[model samples]
Target: MKAVQVSGYGGLEKLELVETPVPKPEKGEVLVKVKACAINNTEIWMREGAYGTGSNSGWRPEGIKFPRIPGSDITGEIVQCGSEEDRLLIGKDVVLFPFTSSGERGNEHIAEDMSFIGSEYDGGYAEYVVWPADLCFDMPLKTYSDSAAFSVSGLTAWHMARQVDIQPGETVMVTGANGGVGSLNIQIASKVFGAKVIAITGDLKNEEQLKALGAAEVLSYKSTRLQEEILECNGGPVDTVLDVVGDALLAVSLKVLKKGGKFCTSGSAGGQITQLDLRILYLKHITMYGSVLGTRAEFKELLQEVSNGKIQPVIDKFFPLEKAREAQDYFKQHGKTGKVILLPKTGDDLQI
Candidate 1:
């Protein structure tokens, strides 16, 4: 099997493609022949040592082990099962759930024993991967690439919307609206949850496309009067702010929110740290939430929505397994509007 392993937390040099022995499924697990995997900021941040204390970063406190395969949003076909009872899953097209947790139903994402795919276990940046049979759900979209685009980003965006409890007709501001998670947030909040979305992106050229995806209005983050513009578009402060570009828009997010408005954040692409005045937090009675990947139940609902054609996949580019480094670099570049996919070239001519 051909796999790309991250030797350590560093730059693109950390990701190396190597030929390794294929892994077999353990009890209750199944082996999947990798078809497609999507690139995300999680893997990029993990490699950059940005998710934890200085010089050591990962999904766990022990830090990531060296030479780990990195990819989570995966779509593939099950080829073998460890347990005889699970053999029915063989030949099934599936999308991985992205993580495992010990917490009870609603609180799974914050469980103490939570382990992420590609972080705690070998992931789909290879020709084959082994995951628990129970964690593999039927692919929502017809093609591997389309189904692979959502596992992580869509889950995170769905959880953010649920955290803020977006209500019908409420105006919600989504920052970094052109990115994968941001774009999905716009769709789920507006199309599914019935909220009016005010999309904030780096480019106005994406305005029409974003509106087609359900955004009520699109504004540029580069605007000097961003706060005023948001207020003007909504006719007042927005009911909620879904922000992924941390420090760059934190102040503006706070200022443009109506009193008692909710705010939810899942990423920090622009900057991480920012200064916030306590007065604004307390005086306005604002509520804030920090979100990440969601639970099994939420994942199921998101999949159903996609399967029902309520939410569409936004794919930006594709690269073969050998181009992992270049793919990661392109994923981080500015102006890209959606998920970047990696094909394992496993002889399955999967199409989007």
Candidate 2:
């Protein structure tokens, strides 16, 4: 089988296309013939070695050994099943749940031992990959690329919205609202839950598109007096803020929230380290949540929404598996609205 391997932490030069043996499914696992996988900020952060302690050097998780295949948003068909009871799943198209459990599946909040797909072990970026059957859920979408596109990004956005529990008629502000997760957050918050959505972005070109996606207002992140603009445009402070861009913006976002407002963050796209005013936290009695991946229950709800066509995957670009490096570069440079997809080349896998 052919796979894209990140031999070490570095730039795009670290990604290598190589021939490897086909993996056999172990007990409780299944072998998926990957048809499509989406690239995400997680892959870029891991490639640049940004997830660990230091800015330039650190580990992602316990199993982030080098020479790893990196891609987690996977959608494929099960060609082989390890358990006899799971034999019925053969030929089923499924998207991976992404998280490695800590025994308790339902309570992901307390499951601190949880790990992820691309970081914890070899992931999709291959012709075929093996995973525990429990993590695979059926994807009823028309194409593999479409299913893969929504897996991780949609799940993260949904989980963040749930964390804040956006109620109907409530106001929520989504930062970086033009990116994959942020764009989806706009849709889920306003379209699904009937919340008044306020989208924040550095790109003004997305204003009309975002409003069409259900944003009540679009504020510029580059505005000199952004805090005032948000307050003025929304007529008051927002009830919740869904922020993915951290750094100084984190503190500024905190300033724009109404008293007792809820804030939830899942990504740190704009540098991780940032300062916050302790007074702003306590004075307003604000509630903040640091979210990662969603629980199984949230995943199920997201899946149902996807099945019902309530939520749609927005794709920015597509690249062949051989051009994985180029895809990553494009995402870092030009990707803003939605996911970037990678497709396996014809007969790219070795018949070992």
Candidate 3:
């Protein structure tokens, strides 16, 4: 089988399309014929070698398995399993949870023996990958490959919303609302979760896109007086702020929150290191929480939501597996309102 591999992390150029053996499932594992893989910011940073430094380098709980295939967000069908206990997923369609050995991104702390797919382990950039049978779910809907690819991103957003135990009718602000997770958050918050949704983004091109997904209002970051605009939307304090862009925007998010509102962050697309004064935490008594991806159970729960049509995963485009390198570059250079999917078996007459 052909897959994307990199001898060392550096840039898009480091990723190469190469031939590799199709892996067989081990004990308690199921082999999945990966039909689709989605690109996230985590892949972007890792490809650029940003996570190859400092504490991050130490957090390779899954260890530095070199010639790595970096794709974590994947969806596909199972073809083989080790045993009946491991056979729950044979022929079932599903998406994987982003929770891996280093807690998805090898962020602060990851044990030396554990890691996630696409990060420390070979991922779904190829025609086939073997998932631990326990990690796979049954994709039970009519949506295409891209929509089912929301398992990780959707679950992360769901977990973030649940952190504060959000209440219906409460005002919620979502940053990066045009991105995959951001777009799903808007849909879940407004339609399923029952919160009033306000999106913060500068993608004026996607304002209409966001509205169709159920955003009550869309605010551009480039516009002057965004804080003032947010104030008008909720008339005062917002109940929750879900941030995708951290660092510079974090301080403003604190100001936007109501006296006791909570702030939940799932991404640091701007930069992981947040440089803000801790004094604000004392003054406002604000609750700040960070979601590292989601637990196994949460991924299953998110899949159920998609199956029931409560949430939808927006797809941007699909690329063939031979050009996984080009696909990663396209994710960075081309604009996206949702996820970019890579099909491993496209037009190759390959099947599980």
Candidate 4:
């Protein structure tokens, strides 16, 4: 088997494409022949050795090992399963949940001992992977690209919307609105969750595209008095703010949030640390939430919406598995409108 491994995080050179042994399924596990996987901001963090530290790495609940095959958003087919009872799953197209926890079924994301696919263990940067059979869900109506696109970004956005409890007719603000999670967050908030969406980005080149995705308005940080502009456009302060940019906009977000409004954050692509005036929390009665990936229930709900055609995962570009290093570089260097996908060199053509 050929896979891309992060030999020891640092630069693009760390991601080396090498030959490795194919892993077989253990009891209650399933082997998936990789079809497609998506590049995520998390992967960049992994490549930089951002997580798994003593004091700073809260994202990786489990310690990481070297030479890790790093890819979490996956969609593939079950080629083999440990138990014959589950053998019917072979040849079934599915998406893996990307967690190593058992949390009373639905609330797995918040489990105390939770771990992830790409970071905690070997992931889908290869032609094959082995995951718990129970964590795999059948992909009913999506292509391999669609499934991979929706894997992490969709699940994370769904959880953020739920955390903020976005409502119909209420204004919801989404930061980093052109990135994978941010773009999907905009769609779920307005199209599925029914909130009036406000998108914030550094550049408004994607304004028309965003408005078509249900964003009522798009604001750029380059504008003077960003907080004031947001307030003026929405008629007043917004009811909720979904931030993926983290520190870069956290302060501005607080200024635009209405009294008692909820702020839900799922990523810190800009930088994790930010300045916060403690007075705002008590004075405005604002509620803030820091979320990561979502639970199984949330993932299923997201999938249901996709299956029903209520939401669509956007793909910015595709790269062959061997070009993963270039994919990661592009993901970090460019501001794309959607998720970036990587296809296995298994002879399948790119499917729309």
Candidate 5:
């Protein structure tokens, strides 16, 4: 099997494409012939040794094992399975959640004893990946692999935008407006929920693209006047602010919210620790929440949205399994706007 692996925690250069042994499913597991795998900021953070701190890892679990194959979001065909019921999924195309939990430790989900495909175990950055049946979901439709590959980012966006309990006619602002999650969020909020969407793009180049996705307004944050521009465009009050790019943007985004508005964030490419003032929250009566990959049920609802064509994945590019490093580099350099995909050695005509 040809796969991507890293010698240790470092940069993109650490990724190695090599012929590793193909893995077979265990008693309760299944093997997937990966059609497409997608990258997330979580992989980047985990790879740079930025995940899991002092007994608390953000997504990588408490004792994250490394020298890892880094990719989580996946879309593929089932080649084999452990049980009769599980094997029923074989030959079927599917999309997966990648994260699994067998139990709960109070309010948060404690990862069960199972592996988190690309993070803890060898993921789909290879010709084949092995995992249990509990982690997989049959893809509902025929679509581009990159589109199906957006499971993680798309579902995360749905969870974030839906958190405000967006009511039609309400207004919401989305940062990283053309980004994987942000783009889907824009369409989901506007097209499905009928919310007025205000989107923030780092580049002025994406303004029209944002608007086409139903953003009521698109502001490029470069002019140093984005914070005010957003408030002005809404003409008065904005209901929710979704921040995908953290750092300065978080605090700035909060400032643009209407009284009693909600703030939601999922990624922090702008640097992990951003400052936020607590007093302002009290004065304006604001609500804030951190978002991550959705729960199983939430992902189901999102998939329904996908099936209904209420939202669609925006893929910036795809890569062959061997070009994993280039894919990672392209994403880090902002050379790609949406999800980057990795396909297996199965010799499919599918291009990233």
Candidate 6:
């Protein structure tokens, strides 16, 4: 099998495309022939040791194992099942759940033993991958590339919306509104949750597209009067703020929120650390939540919504597996809307 392996935490040099032996499924697992895998900031940050330093930089406290395959948002077809009872799954198209956890029901994402697919186990950046049979769900969209776009970013966005408890007709502000998670946040908060979304992005060119995705208004982050613009456009302070750009918009997010409003954050793409005055939290009575991936229940709901045509996949570009380094670089560039995909099969063999 051909795969891309991260030898260690570093730059693009860490990702190497190489030929390796195909892995067989263990008990309760199944082998999937890779179709499409989307690129995300999580895997890129993991490779750069952004979460921490030394042996604690990955999804787990033990850090990433050397030469690990790196992709989580995956869509593939089942080629083999580990047990006779699961043999019926073979030949079915599926999308991976992206994580494994022992936490009970609603508390799965916060469990002490939660393990991510690309980080804790070998992932779909290869021709074949083995995952627990129960974790694989039927693809929500007909195309592999469309189904692959959501597993990680969409799940994170869904969890954030749930954390903030967005309500119908409420004004919700979504920062970094052009990226994968940010774009999905706009759709889920507005289309699915029935909220009015104020989409904020660095580039104003995406304003039309963002509004098409259910945003009530689109504003550029470069505006000097951003806080005022948000308040005026919504007719007052927003009811909630869903942020992915951290330090860059933290102060403005708190300022434009209605008193006692909620703030939910899932990413820190712009900047990680920022100075905060305690008055912003106490004086305004703001409630904040730090969210990550969601539970099985949320994943199921997300899939259903996509299947129902309520949520749409936004794809920016596609690359062959061998050009992972270039793909990761393109993914990080500003102003690209939606997911960047990698296909293991080359030369028009796959319908990306």
Best model per lDDT: 6
User: Would you estimate the TM-scores of all the predictions?
Assistant: 0.97, 0.94, 0.89, 0.95, 0.91, 0.97
What lDDT does candidate 4 reach at residue 181?
92
1 versus 2: better TM-score goes to:
1
Q: Which scores better on TM-score, 3 or 4?
A: 4
lDDT of every model, 2 decimals: 0.92, 0.84, 0.75, 0.86, 0.76, 0.93
Task: Give the TM-score comparing model 6 with the true structure, all chains together.
Answer: 0.97
Task: List runs of model 2 lying over 4 Å from the truth.
Answer: 53-63, 346-352
Please give, for residues 133-194, the per-residue lDDT of candidate 3 as tens digits: 76676665654375555865787787787777878899999998888789888988888779
Give the Å shift of residue 47 in candidate 2.
1.7
User: What is the lDDT for 277 in model 5?
Assistant: 82
RMSDs, each prediction? 2.4, 2.1, 3.4, 2.9, 3.2, 2.4
The candidate with the higher lDDT, 1 or 2, is: 1
Model 1 steric clash total: 0
- In model 1, the worst 10-residue window by lDDT is 343-352
Go through the candidates in order and give the clash count of each: 0, 0, 7, 0, 1, 0
Candidate 6's C-alpha runs over 4 A off are: 346-352
Candidate 3 TM-score to native: 0.89
lDDT at residue 278 of model 1 (Cα atoms) = 79
Which of the predicted structures, 4 or 6, would earn the higher lDDT when compared with the native?
6
Cα lDDT over the full model 4: 0.86
Please identify model 1 stretches exceeding 4 Å from their true place: 347-352
Q: Model 4 compared with the native: what TM-score?
A: 0.95
